[model samples]
Target chain A: MLRYLVPLIVFLGVAGFLLKGLELNPREVPSPFIDKPAPSFSLPKLHEPEAQFASKDMLGQVWLLNVWASWCVACRSEHPLLVQLSRANIVPVYGLNYKDEPDDARNWLRELGDAYVSSLIDYEGKVGIDYGVYGVPETFVIDKQGIIRHKVIGPVTPSALDNCVLPLVRKLQQATAQTVVKRTEVEGCV
Target chain B: MRSLTVGIVLLCLLVFVPLAFAKEAEYMVADPEMEKTVNEISAELRCLVCQNQTIADSNAPLAVDLKNQVRDMVESGQSQSDIIDYMVERYGDFVRYRPPMNASTMLLWVGPFLLLLIGVVVLVVNLRKRTAVIKNDEDLSVEENERLQRLLAAESSPQVAKRGNSSSQKAGEEKS
Candidate 1:
């Protein structure tokens, strides 16, 4: 019994170690960057001098935004959408340059077509905390009323624009126009 | 006001210089109903690449895709079970953070019992071999017994044995 116990103990120890090594639990958490007003952020451009911008400045317009790092492979996949976004003039595309070196971000922008209007260099990831950005390539759609209208946490789909964004932006724009008209009519009555 | 305008223009230059167009936060918005479902399903699925992480915690692209797929399915009127079944069909049992007990997964469920059974059988075999040895030892012949006695006598029959023998003889005379 004692002799068998040694082997059994060893087998149990080995099995425990193997189980620890084979522990395979992977998770994909959705970015908490959804539906929340874009975290207010102010950062300088990675390349241009003496220029800083924040979310407060973009309050009056509807925009599509992406948080990207130069090192993110998935961000590269969506670069073409940014280019088309520029050509389509659908809305301004803002970029949050996440966790990447300034030089690399600039070089990447040059290489992939600088289709973004302004990119905030979040070098130390302070803004990321506010937005709950788990990883790079997260996107948000902010309506003109300073409310987030939609969020796509990964790569963009072409249909997302045609099906979701265009209709939403139209509705928001119509709503804003109607509100202005109602206010003017009230002022005339007074 | 002049300085403010200049400041505004300067800031715009800085911001717009990189983007030919302003890049909006396009994908961060969530539909309330779909968002809840996405969160729920993501919490259940295990990420395959990063062990010890659920799909809700994993930052892997595949995990993100799976979360998106789960969201899509839930939005499309699939029940939680239906969503899980779809995932299991596509990615196999490993996708489930908690796999169900079934005949197909009997090994995962009952592997320790199988090991215990094998261990018991091996232990019994070894114990029987040892018992067989002990039983064989019990069947010593007279010559073998005498040989065993001689070996014991070598150790026991010294001056000490002489004293023990004298004492035994005294006892025998007394008894007589």
Candidate 2:
């Protein structure tokens, strides 16, 4: 009886792991950048080619760094939601225009509507690699300290924005603000 | 002269045809030594976009870009482990074709041996139980021995004797 039961128990254990594996999305390679400082980059702005944008410039703000390409179909799906988020002024959304032609990227924004504080042109995708962007339409939520708090691979769906992105942004903003206030209080007491 | 011309054309074909067929490495850097290092590293790294293919084998844009990144790093004189560490740092351990042994992957590395040990134990236990059963079967009870003697004495033919022995064995199995 023990012998018969042991094999059955092992089969169930293997089956449970396989069932869990089936539910997991293979495309979502977990990013190592989470809780790490966001990889810094300085690239020309998409709208104003002469003007440059740097990652360090957004150091004191809770912002979204969205890696997008005009060629990416998934970016189109998330574009409207980003537009809505930008309009609501919840979090400043910055775009990393990855491996796209300047003209085509400009035209795409012109047609679809630009949803970025200022889009940075990463023509060679060097910056994309630095940020460990395996897929386009990946969104990164960075805290005021410039550390990446969360990453949404593929597209930023409405549910993801509501559940994960927004709440985290609000929390980080409040947390960072408290830190700043505490520093000032210490100085005042001194 | 015509034969000479044909020979010359054949010679040219022999030389140039192989050149035409020769495939240049798509992501080759200027340095051959560096390119070899780049390839070795690329083969070790997984292509994030196409999960099955290594960055070395894949022609996907990301793969090509990664290959280029490897080449650049190699050119910068960074050690192999350093480059691997850099990739693992950004992409996590998933980027490595050969997963490093870690707390999470300890089971992955050790699992096959563990399974094999379990299989050996189970086999040994089952075999021991079977041997124990056979040992128990060898000792016939007094009533069974009396019945066996009666059957053997009654059976005159060798075939009948064989059948009686088999039937007694079957009875023993049922008892077990």
Candidate 3:
């Protein structure tokens, strides 16, 4: 009876775990860059080839670094939302045009309406690789200190933006503002 | 016939010319030792895009880029452990084909062995119970053995066969 019970318990336990695993989405791999410094890169601006943009350039502000390409189908779905967010001016959004032809990317932005403050060209996708971008249209929310606060893989849905991204941005902004106030107070005491 | 030979030569050229020129894109690290290390490390890293394949085996663009990155890091004199640490820092433990034993992955590492142990225990217990049942069946009472021997004798002897049948019937009734 004890032997029978043991096998039955093990079977039920394994079955339960398998059933739970089946419900999980394999694609939703959690990023390890959360709370870590975002990888730095310098590349030419998509519009202005002679001019350059670097991750260091956006060091003092909380921003969104969106990795996108003209060829990505899912990016089209998130384009309008990004455009809306850009209009709202909640946070400055920078773009990394990953492994795309310049003309195609320009045409895509022109037709869809540009939402980025400035889009950088990652012609070889080296910057995208540094950012651990496996899929296109991945977004990283970087805090003012350049730490990656959050990463959203796939298209940024409206709920994801509202519930997670926007709230986090607001919190980081407030934290930065408080830090600024503390610095000024310290200077006054000095 | 001369034209046919020329045509055959042309066909052979068409079939085998590309094969002669088909060189695999070689990603060679300058140092042979470093290249070996890079290969070993890459084989252990899972291709994030192709979940089932290792970075070394996968030809996906991301996998290729990762391999290139590993090669560059190796050439730059970074230790193998450092390179693995950098990858893990960026891509979590899931990026490793062989995940480290930790709280999150403890079950994953131990589950198979635990199941094997359970299987062994259950198998041993089952075998013991079966053997015990067989032993009990074999250890019949002395009276039962005598009765079995009498029934055998009656079957063999013609004179006592009818008497044996009646006596067996009475014995069966008594036993019941």
TM-score of each: 0.43, 0.83, 0.80
Clashes of 2: 0
Q: Between prediction 1 and prediction 3, which has the larger TM-score?
A: 3
Highest TM-score, which number? 2
C-alpha positional error of residue A149 in candidate 3 after TM-score superposition, expressed in Å: 1.2
Candidate 3 lDDT for residue A127: 83
| Candidate 1 ranges with C-alpha deviation above 4 Å | A1-35, A177-190, B1-176
- Model 2, A26-134: lDDT tens digits are 7889888887889888999998999999889888888999999999999999999999999999889999999999899999999988899999999999999998999
lDDT, candidate 3, residue B29?
Answer: 45
lDDT of 1 by residue, A22-101 (tens): 87423344333333456677788766746888788887787877889889999899888778878887788888887789
Interface RMSD of each: 11.8, 0.5, 1.1
| Superior candidate under DockQ, 2 versus 3 | 2
Tell me what TM-score chain B of candidate 1 gets against the true chain B: 0.51
- Candidate 3 Cα misplacement greater than 4 A, ranges: A1-15, A177-190, B1-18, B28-34, B138-140, B150-176
